[model samples]
Target: MEEKSFLDRMLGHLRETCKYYTGYPKYLGPSRVIHFTSEREFVQLLHQGYPVVVAFTIRGNYTKHLDRVLEEAAAEFYPHVKVLRVECPKYPGFCITRQRKEYPFIEIFHSPEQAANQGRVADPNITKYSVKVLPFNYDQSAYGFREFFKRHGIRSSPDPK
Candidate 1:
């Protein structure tokens, strides 16, 4: 049997990880379409007043569990923010490759990397974005992500008036 193409792999991964929504609540302001499979969609999300948080995870041949979590959060908030879970291949290069100067990550496109390259600037504090390196089969992060964001004063939706 032939192997799946990279685009097919990415699209499949996206289908398993994200939930597409048509609109968001009015209080949340506006809904920004999130495209996890394409970099262009990510850039659009950034420009549309929505902050994109990419949660890196791994799943064996499929990604339904991650998608369920992201969908649940999206439904609760709708438009204030967007969350994407990226599936990283299980390989040693995953640790060695630096998308940006200081951030060695498996994700191909990292905003901080772009910023770092355009200007000779780097964030000295690395713990700000430190994520645990989980095994290929371990689904959970070392930190409860929703709680971590809450602790950091990041809200799922805008406060009620």
Candidate 2:
């Protein structure tokens, strides 16, 4: 069997999320939209010690894959890894604080894996993430995302890595 590349591995998780998403409305909270109201709420996501894929949306450019990513993470990893989609309009201050220069991408919190798949060379000072802010990408494939989470120490699947 051929070994999967990081992107393939990550995309696999999103593909598999469909199974769990069909029932999303039944058990999860509020209408499909997810939000982070405060810095504390945002920190709460990262504090879980798991990787959180936080998407920043603006001007109606919806990030479609993130929902699948969230569903997949919830289905496969449950409390281990998660995705939070925040609308930039409602959270104007949040965006300003992060100094966001781009829109419609995923912002990860509490992750130290260098975003190897997302393309920023691994930050040399892993500890700096606690105080300094880092830029993130939202362009990787779903398979790549799963590997990103696992590589960062957030285990999601029952399958052996």
Candidate 3:
């Protein structure tokens, strides 16, 4: 009886150790859509010299549809474009400051020279970078996003090595 109890305790300890090591997966696979969680991350992404598509959304059917569309777009345009989703309900202050009155609004921020030179390295020390914010007015679809990128001269794919 003492040996059985001791074995049970060891198993329990091993289970807890395994649980601690394997908490939760950050992502399932190679997810291109980045969920916005902090201001520092936002700033770092913007300064990475890639066009960023920021979707401001709340919890609803629209958000669900937009999330799928954004994920598809991000996958198709990986490395060239970065997609970010901001849950308005979770960050009400950010949405309010942005004057977001509707759900699933998207804005694209890109450097002025990004269209001409997509490989340009952005200055790290510069607090203020020249960026163009273009409001997305097209339909919420992968094709629409492609058209938007094409219309704005934003590269949809990374350059071939």
Candidate 4:
């Protein structure tokens, strides 16, 4: 028997710590897609050093495919980015407050790492447009999502040495 490395162990723990849905195969990625529970959870992701993408969705005709593509992309960029799906029905106010009225609205929030390097938190009292809201016509394909991430300073993979 061999001992699992710490990184492997931690990823294993986080993989099982998140959401699971039927009718979908297990994602073969380093990071897992999680559910957005609350503002506290959002803050926790920031505090935990993981950049988070929250998808506000409903049972619209386009949502299932949209979610599938989003999850696939997240898997492609695993460990570096975490994706959280939010069912707006459960928390309409959550989406409404952020002005995400359209279904499958995607919002990206900065990690503490980016916040620190960018001098974004000079004053926590003042709010900023730190969140990136994807257009309602946002693409739901892995390639499209990859492009979106790239344009917004998120990497689809880790840097080379």
Candidate 5:
């Protein structure tokens, strides 16, 4: 296989292992949203130690995939931050909540990773927020998350790195 492809596989396997240890809902609290679709990237960022805010349209009419993402995030991290899985699909507009707004999409981000994913279209016309999006998947800004924290802040625990 190509070098990049091999790297991808390696990363995927590593992610799987990380997921196993990230702690699922059975071990978490209400502050975290399990299966946060828009937070897949965000959770990874958290593991890397970035503060972030994750928002999603949890209304029944919305996609189920998003729900799964929330579940995953909740299982992974809870009580550490605020996870808002909004049940309202449609916002102020008559337009369905699925509608994607323009750039600088207003959101609360505890970490730089979640802030970076803002307004980027990860899947299609649908912005990352519309789909079950992990914060990092929407944008690569979180790619530098590790260094960002190291330079400006300190994590109390022993960093696996």
Candidate 6:
């Protein structure tokens, strides 16, 4: 009985360690979409100099649909545009300030240099970061996102590092 109990505890610990390393289990996949985990992660992503597409969404079919679109876009625009999604319900405190009246609010954040060249102003809400945030109000499709990225000068191919 003692050995069985010890084994169970070991298994439980292993499970938790896997969860920590893999991130939210539901999001584990080949998809390039980076699940928003912390403000620190967000800041790091912004500083990487790639255009980031952030989607603030609640749990719903529409959010799932948007996730699929973003996954496709991220796959196509790898190394050029990074895609992230913050589930509002999961992180209410983090999303509270960025939330909109509607669900699945989308925003594209441009790097500081890119924003400056385009004459875009930095978002006051994100004072610490110099990224320019533009509300995405176009069609919610992979093609739409690709076109939007193209329009904003995000190259379809990865920039030569």
Number of the top TM-score candidate: 3
Q: Count the backbone clashes (under 3 Å) in each candidate.
A: 0, 10, 0, 0, 35, 0
lDDT at residue 24 of model 4 (Cα atoms) = 37
Estimate, for each residue in 13-130, the C-alpha lDDT of model 1 and write its tens digit: 6655544532431222233324356545555655555445555545543345555545565545556656555444543243234243322122212122223233433755431222
How would you encode candidate 6's per-residue C-alpha lDDT over 100-132 as one tens digit per residue? 778888999876542334344486454333667
Candidate ranking under lDDT, highest first, comes to 3, 6, 4, 2, 1, 5
Q: What TM value does model 4 have?
A: 0.64
Predicted candidate 4 versus true structure: per-residue lDDT over 123-157, tens digit per residue: 77744324444442446666666777778776557
Candidate 4 vs candidate 5: which has greater lDDT? 4
- Which should have the higher TM-score, number 1 or number 5? 1
User: Per-residue CA lDDT of candidate 3, range 1-161, in tens?
Assistant: 34568887886667545422244322323678998898778878987888899999878876777776787678767878999999888978777877767777999988744244335458755343457889999977778888988899988786679
Top candidate (lDDT): 3
Select the stronger candidate by lDDT from 5 and 6: 6
> Between the candidate structures 3 and 5, which one is better when assessed by TM-score?
3
Question: lDDT value for candidate 1?
Answer: 0.44
Q: Give the TM-score of candidate 1.
A: 0.42
- Candidate 6 Cα deviation (angstroms), residue 4: 51
Pairs clashing within candidate 3:
none
- For model 5, what is the alpha-carbon lDDT of residue 105? 26
Q: Which stretches of candidate 6 lie over 4 Å from their true place?
A: 1-29, 113-127, 159-161
User: Residue 135 deviation, candidate 3, in Å?
Assistant: 0.4
Query: Which 10 consecutive residues of model 3 have the lowest summed lDDT?
Result: 19-28
Which regions of candidate 2 fall more than 4 Å away from where they truly are? Answer: 1-34, 59-62, 111-141, 157-161
Q: Write the per-residue lDDT of candidate 5 for residues 1-161, one digit (tens) a residue.
A: 54568887886667566534334323233435533334355445455443443454534533454555445454443444343454334333322443645322213344333333556556664423222223333321222323333454523224477
Q: Write the per-residue lDDT of candidate 2 for residues 1-63, one digit (tens) a residue.
A: 999999987766555444333333323333333466787776656655666667777654245
> lDDT values of the candidates?
0.44, 0.58, 0.77, 0.68, 0.41, 0.75
